[model samples]
Target: MEEVYEFLKNAKTWYLATVDEEGNPQVRPFGAQNIFEGKLYIQTGLKKKVAKQMLSHPRIAITGMYQGKWIRLNADAIYDARIEAQQSMLDANPGLKHMYQAGDGNTAVFYLKNAVAEICSFTEAPEIIRF
Candidate 1:
């Protein structure tokens, strides 16, 4: 879990894939990530289409590349309604404070559960981590 968090933190900009209402895949670049209560969490606005998609379909995938290596993660996005969870994410990513607050109705934080991530590079065998 720590390894995955480090890789994603360093990667800085990962892509999150969600399924739309029509069953089509939607992918977007995301930068917010953190570990809280031993779970990997991501931040977004509740009003965003991505959040709506995730609410309807919890299964999602994330992919990011850094330094010639890339990570592909599949997980269930569980929304955490607790303020502490929101605060933790905002604390980790201060820039989000400009647009989000812990108790703001628009702010949404989700923890990734049953996650399996594969880190791959052409020069080396893939490393798989589960959390």
Candidate 2:
């Protein structure tokens, strides 16, 4: 889990894939990531389409590339309604404070649960890490 977090941090940006209401795939770049209470958390605005899609479909896949290596993470993105989770995400990403604050009605945070993360490269075999 820690490795996944570190890789994502180093990659700086990850593409998150979610399904729309029509069963179409939607992918977007996301930069905010946080780990709280052993869970990997991501932040977004509740008003965003991604948030609505995620709410309807909890399953998501995230992929990022860094230094000739890449990672693909698949999980059930469970919404954590706790204010502490929101606060943790805000604390991890202070820049987001300008756009979102803890307990704000528009702030949404989801944590990856029952995840399977794979790190891969052309030169090396894929490494599977599950949490």
Candidate 1 residue spans exceeding 4 A from truth? none
Model 1, span 40-95: residue lDDT tens: 99999999999999999999999999999999999999999999999999999999
TM-scores for all candidates: the values are: 0.99, 0.98
Best by TM-score: 1
Worst 10 residues of 1 by lDDT: 1-10
Q: Give one digit per residue, the lDDT tens place, for model 2 in 40-118.
A: 9998999999999999999999999999999999999998878999999999999999999888888899999989999
For candidate 2, report its TM-score.
0.98
The clash count for each model shown is 0, 0
Error of 2 at 109 (Å): 0.7
Report how far off residue 108 is in candidate 1 (Å): 0.5
